[model samples]
Target chain A: MQLTSPDFPRNAAHALHDAALQRALGNLKAGFPGKRAAAVARLPEFEALRDLGRDLKNHIIEHLDYYLEQFEASVQRQGGQVHWARDAEEARAIILGICQRAGAKTVTKGKSMVSEEIGLNEHLAAHGIEPIETDLGEYIIQLRGEHPSHIIAPAIHVNLDQVSDAFHQHHQQYGKHERQTEPRALMNEAREILRDKFLRADVGITGANFCIAETGQTVIVTNEGNGDLTQLLPRVHIAITSIEKVVPTLEDAATFIRLLARSATGQEISVYTTFSAGGRRAEDLDGPEEFHVVLLDNGRSQMVGGEQQDMLRCIRCSACMNHCPVYGAIGGHAYGWVYPGPMGSVLTPQLVGIEHAAHLPNASTFCGRCESVCPVRIPLPRLLRNWRAREFERHLTPQGYRFGLRAWAWLTRRPALYCGLTRLGARLLRWLGGRSRRIRSLPLAGGWSAWRDMPAPQGRTFQALWAERQRAAGMEGKR
Target chain B: MTESTKRAPAAGRRVALLATCLVDLFRPTVAFAAVKLLEDAGCHVEVPVQTCCGQPAFNSGDRADARALAEQLIAAFEGCDYVVGPSGSCIGMLRHYPELFEAGSAWQVRAAALADKSYELLAFLVDVCGVEQVDAHYAGCVTYHDSCSGLRELGVKAQPRKLLASVSGLQLKEMEEAEICCGFGGTFCIKYPEISNRMVSDKCASIVASGADTLLAGDLGCLLNIAGKLKREGSTIRVRHVAEVLAGVADEPAIGDGE
Candidate 1:
């Protein structure tokens, strides 16, 4: 939530050296992409479905105000209320007001990145209301007093031992003090502890994967079903989501859900896909008595008709990060935000200004794996390049880098001068290497020569050799 | 000597070899191998007076300079029947030049025309020239590293492998995650060397696990990066450009190899 994106380089270096984090990141590389591939291979229409998802989101974003108004009327028709917050502070205040009105002592929350973006937990705790994370990953991270390193998998950077230790330390008061080595044991312990909190909580808040304008329904897909209990058992239920989540129809929600689960976790469908519309009906036996939806704009509306419009189509499935090698190496905390990876690289700059988050866009190899795997076909690499262009245009890039690029470009524009200089440089490098034919280190290239040897040039430029060959062939023809 | 019957085309086509800046400065044998392969494929090859492809600037966010270099490149090979390069990364940059210009502008039109005529060497050979195989041989097991640009940008996964199948005794052993980047993203290796080093280190481990005596790749930047790491770690695996191996001209000493 805080703007640590400026420290991305330092964070990446730290993550690279953190052995436990590296081990956790290894599982991400080995696990997600293959499952998604197999899942995609099983469906012949996966690409077509991605197209539909993209088109549907594009249609909604183009006419967002109309859809939001329609969604508001639908929610009001179902005895629910809609609140619009222009930014994070407004959204936080709106949620706090609802909790205060309900006289909530404690609140349970499903996994919501919007809440993290707004620093919601800290705000509630400051107001004397206890906020408990009901999602398993979110709960583990909350106990550790850390932010969600990853979007969907909040505690992905934490290893099994770390989780075991956290649970052992945190769950001792619940009379389950021994450290549980088995994952299922840990899950059962968490379930037991959270069940009590779920019953006592006066308010429940969750994030909606989709807000269906057709039926005033908010959809959430989770494997653990923690979201259902979080919203159902409380007296007051609130859903906090950004405006872009609103879709025109349930069929569009179905189309996106088909891609979201497979792209996120490689499941054809998550175990629990719950759809809730407003509060409990008069005929309903049990449900929340009050329902509210908070829509946060938070600079998203400005992205419409801009270069970053495609980024708004993101389903937050995180397929881009799952396939990204840089993320596979550094983990998500290095991104230093609620979102991470390629999507984060493009979106973080928009939310936090480029001056604070420039490194996010520059930290890619431009391998295009993110774009290749994106279900919505967001041209992620091109968007990153666009960010770079903006960074350059604003003169936000370092002076040294700009000068170096200008010098190189000036030299490259002149073929004869460029060829002559490179020929000399190549010879000099070869001479410096002597017979070893590899430079162990060089000035200004310590970064490259740090972990690898720089191979010496072949002592002659190709142009010179080609010119000699052409001359010899011309002489032979004359003879 | 016969695995299958395929022959080079009769000579007629004029092909310009845009030897990338790396080949022009660091490794000329790659350029020579490319010329040999093209000449053998019944094409009259000419070396254009070309500099860098402006990818470094384009990628570094210096579009003004990148466009200047792109315009220079467009003028250098204007009359050639086809523009081919040994490195897929540079060729991909050529293809992307059109995107750098404003739509419907004259420069954009020129960039688009140049992009249409450009091809990476292996793709040009197998796809355009219809050269089924090369009259070359290498008697060792070698694994190919699919550089990201060649593999993803140009769809060049099968072209080199398809041609390598015809080499007399070359056993193509596939490495795990071969398509992953070797982290020689032009300026990327220098700018983010630690992360780049880790990626290449992972790549080297995969290459070692394949039990191949030699490593090959389509892009010289990746080849150079991988070779540097292998040499630094004191591994015996040889590294060379795929064109050098396919042209039977790789005998000059592999990259980073000498007394």
Candidate 2:
């Protein structure tokens, strides 16, 4: 997908006015955040579990090479093949090679963020193989010829009407005539239509929530059960994920899974927590004939031991974005990448270069909400600040902002100049306020004054008045 | 700050008031109100020479300037027993000062010392100074907006409400999503005003829905943003710093009251 991250401000401005997207975003207020809060309240040991998860992920990352080799060997022992891709280019090529070897005409996929990160669907389609998304949200967005706006809920940005419209426009070839607007009706339609593709597809690609090293198993947590169908029904099963997802054992994976459901959708356990040990055994009645695991490093290898290594602990639960006010305001599409919100802000810069995605980090208010609710307790605000520091050091910050910060810093360090400027600034602002005591427009701060009236300074700095009070009362003399 | 206002409680412990650049320039009355509250709680308060906590530079990734400012603040208030400020944001910045210096260095030790002594006005009043209620009176019902830094960073949520509960003739109505950010994130408001506007607009809607005639908060940045948007939307909600109400100096005028 083409990246619009450089135009974040433009995308955000346009998103704010888009009535449909706003209405869809409004539902987020009533959903995940409240449920997650309730779920966390129900489990008293949830915080302790989070700490364990963090430590486990840290240990796994520190020994990533050892565990990955162990995992590959285990997968081979279990009659499954594992492929490592250093980056997106190699990852896509490896997946395409698997499909071509299987002579796949059609491939069905469950929701996978790594797939989106690698731009897999478009690549596969361009190579003359049809890729079908079985997840209902994915299918709606797919029908609209759009990428998933949100990670878990792919078509969350599209409302019921938009779904009906997309389905009405695209479902004509399926011999379905009526536009289904009811939630149940739309689900049934999507289910019926995707059922055919799931059965007919030669290869299935799904994302792994966890890849257990000891058991050589991959896990996918879902509510719709589409992942089970996508992997089981196809002749070839391919689980595509990033390298940081590997865990040392099933027990460690269990700990992460416990945190994931509660943080992601507030469920004790998702309706379907399916695990694949390997391809079907000789006597197995139903399972794929060939099983393959594609591990994509992308930028994760460099990130493993860096300052942003904390980000690798993310279980993709999206608790950060679910509770983020900034995400609540603009929705996911404005982030202008496959990932959006807090996790996206950090990961996007790592995957995509910081120059192209500079606005992502600068856009936050550093409110600390994302950090507070993050399941793995990634210090998102600090990471975002680190990016800002990186930007400033690299001369990537906007010239006006850099100069303003420099002037602010210089004046602040010198109390005398700072006080003088503040006193004069107070007087200027108060006079600008005139009798109303407010300025509707400011000289250079149009971003603030354009929409909100700046409350005028109360006239004269506090120190000046305090000095007068001190002299009159002989207060400092007594001190 | 130690000499004039009220009698000694902790044997007249010297507390330095940071005065935060915003409270100093935009709302000096908040500093005075803070002084009155501190003095009434049987403590001495000192207004030291200060400009800012370097939050703008720190948050904008200007670490060199941020560290310079932190070093200066540590030096300026070293003589005082405690450093208190009316802003959660500025005081919160001080709490993270140790991160600016090299680990285990002398400067880091001083930064940690400075941070340990720093407290937001409301938290210090209730938590440290043992202030239960105020002699202040305000007749109107008010809903408080929890500034994010104070709420999350310093745990200033219940202290303000607990104190506000005792004010004579005051009704503390709570707004839904009061803990959410009002979008006045220092430079964040200026850089992303439209998004900030949307956030503040939602905040205003919640404030309006609470049916309170007035709004109070600890930080001036949030107050200015909310008050600015409240006025632009033509709402009659009077806005004031929480310190003003607690000190009973609210009679001066609501923020932006003159014209």
Candidate 3:
């Protein structure tokens, strides 16, 4: 929840040293993309469903005020409360106020990236209220006192062995009475510990994947069923979600659901997709006494009229992250923000401003896998470039880069000088390569040549070749 | 080469080949390769007086400057059959340029035209030209890295494979996470060296695992990064532009021609 604009140097150092994190991240590169492809192959209507999903999200965002009003009104009518928080501080304060009024000593939470975004737990704990994370991944990260490296897998940076270590240290406190190293054992131990917390917790906080205006329901999709328990067992339930999570109807939500699970976890549907409207209705077997829906704007309103409005349609399925090579390498931590991967590359800069998050946009190979896999079809690479454009406009970029670009631009404008420089540069590189035919190190290029050899360029430019070929073919060349 | 299958339009397509700064300078052979590929695919490949694709400007966040250059490119590439490019990144820019400009502006109209005909080589090969195979062959164990723009924006995933599949004796072994970025995002490698190093290293490791003698990609930037890493590690693998492989001109210059 506390957004640390991670300095790239420090984050990269940590990512490099963090072996457990690497192992966990390695699993996602193969596992998630493979599953997603298989899932997409299964659904004949997948592309149509994606278009519907995009349209529904776009429509909801276009008329967010109406949908929010409709959703809030329905919640109020169903004996629930709705709070609109202008920013993270207000959202956190509202949740804290709810906890204080509930006389809540302990609060159990489902996996909520928005709550992480708002820094809800740290605020609650500072006020002397205990917050227990019920989701297994979130619980692991919570135990380790680290941020959720990934949106879907909060503890994606932790491997099975590290989870075992976390359990060994925390299990005694939970009275589980044993240390477990196997994934299944660790999961069972954590599940047993969280089940007790679920029952004893006075309040529940969860994130909504989608909030249906038609049903006036906040929907949560989870594989572990922790979200359902976190909401149902507690006397009071609070949903913290961004404003863009709203959709017009249940039918719209269903279309998104068709794409969401496939994109997120490669499942047809998450093991549990629960929708709760307000609090308990009369004759309900088990339900919360009170429900609160807190919609937080937190900079999204600024993006609505701009070129970046398309980003608001993200369902946080994280297919982009799973498929991203950069995310695969450094894991999510190096992005230095809660959202990592292609979405994070674009969104982090927008949320935190380009100066703080500038390195993120430049961190892509522009492989477009993220866009290809994105259910809502956010053009992430272009959006990232837009952020870069903003950075240049503000003069926030480093001075060396400015000088480099200026010189390059100046050279490019003059064909004679441009060709001369390239020919000379190529000759210099080829010379530098010598008998090895590869330059292992050079002053400015040492960074590149550090792990990769610089290939000697062939002396002539393509323009020269085309001109020669045109003359050979007896065509009057443009030049 | 096939006959031009003109789609219904009067906006009159005249495509300028954005022969990428890399292809133009280091690998002019690729530029010519792209020309042959595009012309064979049916569009008149024009070499406009263009330089960098404004990616350097765009990525540097000089939107106004990038827009200026983009405007110039739009003007230069105007009245083309289609603004085709050999590089994925440049083609991506052409295709997505309208998103950068105000809709209904003169620049937007030109940008739209530039994008409409602009195709990364393979996308132009299969999607535009609709060529199933070229009369070319290179017998080698090769693996393809899906450059981000070609894979995503242009949907060139199957086009390269479809063409490569026809090459007699060319074994195409699929690399793991072939679509994952090589992290050679132009300025990215220079700006964030540590993260970029990590990414490119992973990419190299995967390519090495494929036991590929040659790693092929549409984008020179990615190949340069991966090849640099592989070469630095002293791996005995060669990196060739997809065009070079497709043109069947990748082998070390036929026995003693230079000698």
Across all models, the iRMS values in order are 3.7, 1.4, 4.4
Off by over 4 Å in 3: A174-177, A465-479, B1-17, B35-49, B79-83, B99-101, B125-133, B166-169, B251-259
- The model with the greater DockQ, 2 or 3, is 2
Candidate 2 chain A: 10-residue stretch with minimal lDDT: A470-479
What TM-score should be assigned to candidate 3?
A: 0.91
lDDT of 2 by residue, A281-335 (tens): 9899999999999999998999977888999988999888878888888988899
lDDT of 3 at B136: 81
Looking at candidate 3, what TM-score does chain B attain? 0.89
lDDT of 2: 0.91
DockQ of each: 0.56, 0.77, 0.46
Over A71-162, each residue of candidate 1 has an lDDT whose tens digit, in order, gives 99999999999999999999999999999999999999999998988889999999999999999999999999999888889898998899
The count of residue-pair clashes in candidate 2 stands at 2
- Distance from true location, Cα of A377 in model 2, Å: 0.4
